[model samples]
Target: MREITGKQITDAIKKLVIEANYKLDDALIKKFKESIEKEKSETGKRILEQIIENAEIAKDGVYPLCQDTGASVIFAYVGEEIVFKENGNGESILVSAINKGVSESYVEGYLRKSIVRDPFDRVNTKNNTPAMIVTEIVTGDKMKLVYMTKGGGCENMSLLKVLAPAAGLEGVKQFVVDTVENAHANPCPPVFVGVGVGGDFEKCAYLAKKALMRGINEKNPNPFYAEMEEDLLERINKTGVGPQGFGGTITAIAVHVEAFPCHIASLPVAVNIDCHSHRHKEIIL
Candidate 1:
């Protein structure tokens, strides 16, 4: 078995968190440029241009792309052949290390602290600790980490609905389009829409959030879902929400759909919206 040290995980997570906030993903930048060309409205085109400029400036690491630094969300695929070494703490070494890394990155990198200790109490965490971590075991010896900085505005606008199986494909399509239409400007226009179809209630939401990690230019591997993604993108842009919801032809940069099997009785669909600065990073170690 391969043993991975706690420090290695901590250092890697710290680096990823700092970089993800400071640098916009290249795929997203390309989408912005493409969106600019597709945008017919003069105002929308200008907004897209400004977004590209902002990304350029943020690349220097002087300022983050968005004021909301976001909560650190990680999807870790750990190999069954690997084992994480204990950190001498009684708690789960992996979890503790990840949280330590996240807290340090937020504090040392000077990113805004947005996570709160409690939903009702509303006190700031100050260091953005306790990252939302999901771990899955796979076959390889290495670990693959997909890190995302999930901002509140778009996350708050995400929705899930349990449709009767009879609602079928048309229902799923309408639900996704309606969610984007109802979201309007709240999630910020020129958004990336991640749609999760099938799966149970919570699983569907998780799938929707996970869907956001796919590169903006990448399509679902399954042709069926990929075609649905394309259709959703077309339908959403036709809404004319435009850049920042100012009104234009390029409302959504891309629509990604992830699906899983579910019981025959229910079809759970989730729409997770992400603003123009859809910040995510991935690394294998």
Candidate 2:
């Protein structure tokens, strides 16, 4: 079995956090540039241009692309054939490494600390420790980690609902469009919509978040869902929310849907909205 050390994990996570903060993914940048040509509004064109410039500036690493550096959420896939070498630290090796990385990146990288210790008290976790880590055991020998910098503005606009199975496909469409339209301009328009159409309550939400990790240029593998994604994209853009909600031809850059099996009586749907800057990076070890 391959031995993976805590030190390696810690260093990798730290670099990822800092690097992800400063750099916008190239695929997303391509979409932003393309959207500029399709945008009809003069104001929208200007907005897209400024966005492109901001991305270029951010690539220089002077500051993060967004003021909200966002919550450090780690999606970990552990391999069955590898052994995680433990340190003397009592914490789970992976958890400890992730926390250390977050703390170091937020402090040393000068990223913003937005996490609070309590919902009511509203005290900041100045060090940005205790990052949210989600792990799963996968059938492979290589471990993988995906670090997502999820900003609050778009996160707040996300929605989850338990619909009756009878609600059907049309209902899913309406709910998703309504959720985006209701947000108006808050989530920072030209959003990427991730829709989870099945699974149970909590799983449905997870599916939605995972869906956003997909590249915007990709499509759902299932032909039905691929078509659904296309229709949803067309409808959401029709909302006229446009770039930064200034009314344009492109309200959303993409719509990705990930679905799983669910209980017979329940149809759970979740929508995770990501602003124009949908950021994430993956590392295979």
Candidate 3:
């Protein structure tokens, strides 16, 4: 087994958190550029241009792409063949590393501290950590870490439901499209919609969040889901919610769907909305 040091993980997460907050993903940038061209509304086109310009400026580190630096949402895939060495303090090395990175990155980057210490208390965490961390064991020798700055606006607009098995495909499609239409511009316009279908309630929600990690330019690997994604994208854009919701042709940039096997009677569907920033970064170690 390859031994991974806690310090190494800490440093890596810190780097990724800061960089992702400042620089928008290249794939997402490309989508914005393309969206600008396809946008029929003059106002929408102008908004798209400003978005591109903001990305360019943020890339230089002068400021983050959005005022909301976001919560540190981490997805760590620990390979079966790898072992994370414990830190000296006896805490879980992985958790320590992640939180340390999150804390340092937020302070150093001057990003906003948006996380509260408790739901009821409503006190600021001050450091923007500890992260909302998720881990999965996967077949591989390399540890892959995906860091996403999930903005509150878009995250708050996410939706889910446990549909009857009979609801099936049409139900899911209509639900997703309706969610976007209802959201209007709350989550920001030209959003990427991640849909999770078929899994149990919680699993479906996780799948929906994870689906946002996929590149906007890529489609679902399964032909059925791929078609569904395309259909949803078209239908959502047809809403004319436009850029920043002022009204235009390209409301949503893309739709991504991830599916899992479910029990016969249950069909759980989730929609995780991501704003135009699409702040996510990945690294393998």
Candidate 4:
């Protein structure tokens, strides 16, 4: 078995947090450029141009693309063949590494300290400690880490519904479309919609959030779902929410869906939205 040190994980997470916040992924940038060319509304096209410029400036200046630095989320896939060594702290090495990374990155990268230690007191944690970490055990020999910075505006607007199995696909489609329309300008326009279907309530919610981590314009491999995505994009744009909800076309850049097996009696669906500045990064070690 290969043994990995906690320090390595800590350092890697810190660097990823800083880098991801400052730079838009190339795939997302390409999509924005394409949108600018095809956008029907003059206002929409101008907003797309501003977004592209914001990304470029953020990368060149090493500044955050959006004012909201977001809550740090870490997804770790630990291989059964690898072992993590703790330095006699009695804490899980993995947890320690994550905390270290989060603290260091938040301070050095000038990220906002958004976490509160006590919900009642509402006191800031100062270091953005205690990252929301999700860990999975896998078959491989290496660990894979993903960092997703989720902004509060879009995250707060996410929703889930448990539909009777009788609701069927039409019900699912309407629920998603309705949720976006209800959200209006709240989640920020020009959003990326992630829809998760099937799984139980909680699982579906998680799946919806995970879907947002996909590349901006990547199509779902399932042909039916891909068509659903395309159709949803068309319908959402027709809402005329426009960029920043100023009223125009191009309200959403993409609609992604991830579904899983579920009980026959229930159809749990979730809608997770990401604003134009969807930020995430991944690394394998």
> Candidate 4 on 79-182: residue-level lDDT in tens?
99998975798999999998999999999888888888987998899998889898889997899998988888988888999999999988998898888878
Candidate 3 lDDT score relative to the true structure:
0.91
Cα lDDT tens digits for candidate 1, 112-196? 9998899999999899977999998899899988899988999899999999999999999999999998888888788988899
C-alpha lDDT values of all predictions: 0.90, 0.89, 0.91, 0.88
| Candidate 1 residue-wise lDDT at 2 | 93
- Write one digit per residue (lDDT tens) for candidate 3, span 1-285: 899998889889988988898988787888889888899999999999999999999998979999999999999999999988866787899988999999988998899999999999999999998899999999878999999999999998999999998987999899999998999999997898999998898999999999999876788989999999999999998898999999999899889999999999998999999998889998898
Candidate 1 residue-wise lDDT at 31: 75
Which ten contiguous residues of candidate 1 have the minimum total lDDT? 86-95
Per-residue lDDT for 130 in model 4? 81
Structural RMSD, model 4: 1.4
Candidate 3 residue pairs in clash (backbone atoms < 3 Å): none
Candidate 2 lDDT over residue span 26-80, tens digit each: 8888888899999899999999888889989999999688998898889999999
TM-score of each: 0.98, 0.98, 0.98, 0.96
Off by over 4 Å in 2: none
Deviation in Å, model 1, residue 100 alpha carbon? 0.8
Best by lDDT: 3
What is the C-alpha local distance difference test score of candidate 2?
Answer: 0.89
**Against the correct fold, how does model 2 do in TM-score?**
0.98
Error of 1 at 168 (Å): 0.6
